[model samples]
Target: NQTKMFDEKKLDINDEKYSSFGAVLTDDNNFYFTSARNTARKTYGANEQPYLDMYMATYNADGSFSEPTPISDINTKWHDGPAAVTADGNTMYFSGESFKESKQFERDKDNNLKLGQIYLFKATKTDGKWGNIQPLPLNDKTYSTGNPAISADGKTLYFVSNRPGGQGGNDIWKVEVKGNNTYGEPQNLGDKVNTPGNDNFPYLTTEGKLYFSSDGRKGFGALDIFVIDLAKGTEAKNVGLPVNSGQDDFAFSFNDSKEIGFFSSNRTGVDQLYSATPICGVEAIVMVRDANTGKPLASAKVAILDERNNVIETRTADTNGKVTYSVDCDRAYTIQASMSGYENNSFPIAKTHGGEVNVMADLRPIVEIVKEIEVVLNDIFFEFDKSNITKEAAFELDKLVEAMNNNPEMVIMVKAHTDNRGSAQYNMNLSNKRAKATVQYVISKGIA
Candidate 1:
């Protein structure tokens, strides 16, 4: 997995009362998200939903956010924000289509002036109100710059922009966040993180890992969340499901104090918020196949066994001959696969040390063809004139029992011959006893 699975929980859960799309949890017990639920706001012509407004709520101790209230001072007639509050929770940077005095209105592609062309706006929080808002210097009439994410130290600012010198549509760009609201020159994030597709909503973590959404790279859906570790390298890896769905999933952020994460997805038909936590366990993908033919054995039952060799659970293989088991890390386990007409096979899985891994089980087919017409058996020897079956003679008798079981309709003739040292009557009597003992032995082995 380029990314691990997220133990996700949907906060909205089919309650589409609002269309919320981003999450920003701050150290000051503040939670921020963008939504179009405010009926008082004017509707934008693009989606016909109420204009997006910045909403603030309390991050509860129970890992739930309080009822969100729009930041009325910051919310304007046009779209307000999907914001990033700094580590100190004092300075905030957000994408807004509202600032009126910042150069009137922005022009569209047809040179039409409208309430579009989002730009990064910096705001300061004091006494529970957001004010002193000013657009970043990088915003221009020729291009659009928005979706701001700042580093923990507030020195670097990462954002999405279709501004000049980009890979194509929207590329992630970063700038230095100097003191006094002044900034450094913006630079593109290069082709590695920025693809020709639409990449937006960048979220920076304290560990220098940047989580963002993009349609440029191959993903489960249109906009899938991806992360790139600045310390590791710049290969933006997709954060696999259930954080990523086959629909739009974006704007991933973490709350380090609570050890919880949050993201937004339209997988429920409407954009909604989802809380995510890292799944801590091992994922074993068991692939069943034929031992000789190397073909997938679908419908095969795969069982996970504990250390005591008792089956914990069993799962049937899908069309791809694959089934997965979630087990504890650094633990030994056994997997057994079985299918009709194929011998059951079991394989020991070594300790995974906590990661996703692939395991294989090959089943040999049980050949049922009987090619022999006449069944033959070697002579069975016994101790001197004894009626009891000896260990050596029992070995040959077991083969006869197996043959009788293999061919249920075939009958066996027991002819126990002995030496000429005894009388004819005594030899006959001895042979009868030996034959009876052999028959009893076969019956003891549950053979009819």
Candidate 2:
């Protein structure tokens, strides 16, 4: 469940401060993200970073990008940017604040605290430049509304705000975009999607799935990306792993097909934009257990071998006797498992495009074969005249080794029958050498 389900690529547009992430794959090929790398701008007291400015660059298909340029027309000295462009790319809705009435900083008026609130502004691109910028009616003096996301059809606008009648904190609200650039009343998405915690950055896909960021739900960490199907009217589900982590992850945007996408996260401690591609690789999970009892064998050794039988990695299984590996797409693998007091086993994993491959290893327990303290086998007569332990004698020694393994406290004294093939002194020496050889053979098979 914690696997990286997506083939994610970090964007090069990231600065050490904040490279930003919002709308992606605009029609003009223009990229947008927030950056606070400009030391020239005064630092905001909130996060202690420089004030954010709308940065732009030319996006390439190979995940390469041109140098970022600040959108001066929409970027005020205050924090700006994180803009959403319509399907045509002619219209843009961005987050910024007006500097009118000495409101850049220090709202001195005791009752005038609205100067610092963020506003959603709409701008039109003409002759390759953004102008005719104006704030949307959703902005108010008492509350903040910004981070706008326009639906693909341009009939609905989704954004974050702390206005009245909200679920709490920052909630995602939508308004109907009527004819003539007019908007209907803003409506909260309700508790299904909105919580009493901060929820922001909504990107609605043409397929009716709304992807947004929130700290309100259960996730790996601070903020995670979630998706709720607006058509199905279900609660949001956490889009886990690679896309989310033990840090703030938000601002998810996917193309029309929801294949290629972009999202921002502070998993590295510095916020950056990451390009997400669906992982077509296969996930192989192996579980090892006892063959006879059918119970899990903990701490069993599992080795993953490639198609050529070359060992990739030898890892120990978890408490549940499970070990997982990220295998390549369309590549076959073999999972070999081994444990003490059990015979080793191996299983096969077939090639797959993008899914899980579960394999189970059932190992046979080493049964006790040695019964009596003294035993003479049928085809096993030791050559007491020589020092070399015969193959027949070694075979019986394995049974003794298995017996010692089963009863750790059992100790055996070896005795050898001698032949009068030489002098009495020579026969006595042969008997001692044969006894030593028998004990050595059993000790070699892991018997103490």
Best by lDDT: 1
Q: Give per-residue CA lDDT, model 1, range 205-286, as digits (tens).
A: 8878888899989989799999887776847778897888899999999876666789998887889988998766787989
Candidate 2 per-residue lDDT over residues 171-284, each given as its tens digit = 999999884557999999999888999999999877788999989899887998998988868668887887888999899887754367889888777888898887677878
Model 2 segments beyond 4 Å from truth? 2-4, 98-115, 280-448
Name the lDDT of candidate 1.
Answer: 0.81
RMSD (CA, angstroms), candidate 1: 12.3
Report lDDT (Cα) of residue 409, candidate 1: 84
